[model samples]
Target chain A: MEEFEPKIVAFCCHFCAYSAADLAGSMRLQYAPNIRIVEMPCSGTIDHRVLLKALEDGADGVFVAGCMEGDCHFLKGNYRAKRRVSHVKDLLRAIGLEPERLEMYNLSAAMGPRFAEIANEMTARVKGLGPSPFRKQTGGDA
Target chain B: MIVAEQKPLAEIAGMIGDCRKVLFAGCAGCVTVCLSGGEKETEVMATALRMKRQLEGNPLETVTYTATRQCDPEYVDAMADVVKGVDAVVSLACGVGPQYLAARYPDLWVIPAQNTTFAGGSKEHGVWEEFCGLCGQCVLHLTGGICPVIRCSKSILNGPCGGSQYGKCEIGKDVECAWHLIYERLKRLDRLDLMRQYREPKDWSKARDGGPRKVTREDVMIG
Candidate 1:
């Protein structure tokens, strides 16, 4: 059997995490290639549907990367995102999926190294968890 | 407005057992404002059901439709096209939605996905408390706008029932004694004298004891 390569979807706020990813690339950081970063206006804009859609479309894991606590460009966008992420986690668990498959992180735009670190960390965690049950049931690829 | 809560996913799944296709009908009325049933909840339910059934090796197809107001026959009639093909309909609206859908499509099976909890409004985001007992009477004027029929555990007309202590009801510490609240409010409004007036028993004829009720306005009737 081929080694499992998890597909991870990372929703990054444009004001922070997305910029951090760009900075990570500019700084020659080597992060996990498995992370697929999706840019949004703000982490708060990442709706529950978008997260669930990522999983339904074969993502092994999904995470939202937002601005550091109390530092959101929109004041409370990151806080709202935190609450929404928690709600989605509960929904995921109710559907029999591993709640750990989804996560939320906060970091500043200048934290390029942390961005790469999170990508690698999330990728490793998802790899350990293997493919999502939805992927397994649908006979999807690794 | 009516407040409702979605039934457990497991119970809903069991109710839809062996059905290959189901329609999830959502209401854009009170349930939407209450966050119980609406377009978002309907989609969430469909996704959850599809995921659950797929994992069990019995893939289920789900269609989602949201009516303007499920309690109205005209709005429910709008779903005729979509309702034709589904094996069953799982209404995410309050109890009224399923009954209306069932009435509209007599041949199709309609089931409720929510427990019609009460008529109330949200005290805050994601929290709702019962406010009306649907007793077919309005006594808020006499009670200083506080409803004792539903808010009070015992529905005492003249009470802080003997079990009331610290303004809380005996039934639960979390529940405030409704009569006490009414008294305080009336006191503040300088209508405390209303509390002393001997209250007559509530007339049950106007309530559910009279069976299913209807409100008609002859002036608004169409030819």
Candidate 2:
């Protein structure tokens, strides 16, 4: 049986994660192709609704990748993202979904290798969790 | 502003039993400001409900609409078109929002997604504290801005009751003594004389006592 290949949605900050992903490409860093990135002006712009919508649309896993601590391009945007991520994780748990399906990560634009590493890391983590419970149920609904 | 908290998912889900589709009505008024019900919350709830139901092998179809103010009949009327396509209506506003929806669409099932907590303002970013009791009487003029009715916990009219210790209510140190705050305010304003007069007992009939209260203003009456 082929191992489950999780569909991961990453809300990436344009100033950090997106830039790092581009850099990873320029550096020829290879990572899992399971991730579909949604670029935002700031990680803080990622609403709780956006994350939930991703899952409701059949994404196996979701994450917000932002700037490192105290390094948000828009001051406290990353911090706001962190708080929102925590809130969504709790919400997921309440809905009987694995909180592990949702996550928050911080990396600078200079971390090209780190960006690729995180993509591979999240892909592996979600793969271990298998297809999201909502996949079959929400696929047709979505 | 009216502060409200979202009801637990289990309770909300239970209230939606046997329904395959629902309309989530959100209000963009006080509830929006309090962060309980708004466009964002409306969408989030619809998504959550759909996913939860889907996981149970019972798919749910959801539609969301945010009215300007659910307490007003005009706003509730706007959701009429959306209500026609769903099995039930879930109001994300305070308690009044659901009542307004229910009254407007008598045949439709309306459920409240939030528990209306109180009339108050935010203390900080995410914390709200009750400031008004909606007793149909305004007494802020007599009590120096801070309301004793709701804040006092005991609703003591003439009190720093014996339970007041160090300006804190005996109920808990965290709770401020309403009378203590009143005295301090009147003192600062040099109006301590107002506190000297013996106060008469309030007329409770002005409140929600007469089996649902109404104030008719003929001047604003249409037709």
> What is the Cα-based lDDT of residue A120 in candidate 2?
94
What tens-digit string does per-residue lDDT give for candidate 1 at B1-223?
9999999888899999979999999999999999879999899889878877876779899999888999998899899998988999999999989999888888999889999999998899878999998988878998999998889888778877789889989989998999989989999999999999988998877888888887899999999
- Root-mean-square deviation (CA) per prediction: 2.0, 2.4
Model 1 lDDT tens row, A1-142: 9877888989999999999999999999999988988999999887877787788767899999999999999898899889988987887777677888899999999999999999999989999998877665555544
Error of 2 at B165 (Å): 2.4
lDDT on C-alpha atoms for all candidate structures = 0.89, 0.89
Q: Give me the displacement of residue A135 in model 1, in angstroms.
A: 3.8
State the weakest 10-residue window (summed lDDT) of model 1 chain B: B48-57
Evaluated at residue B36, the lDDT of candidate 2 is 88
**Residue pairs whose backbone atoms clash in candidate 1:** none
Give the TM-score of each candidate.
0.94, 0.93
lDDT of 1 at B129: 91
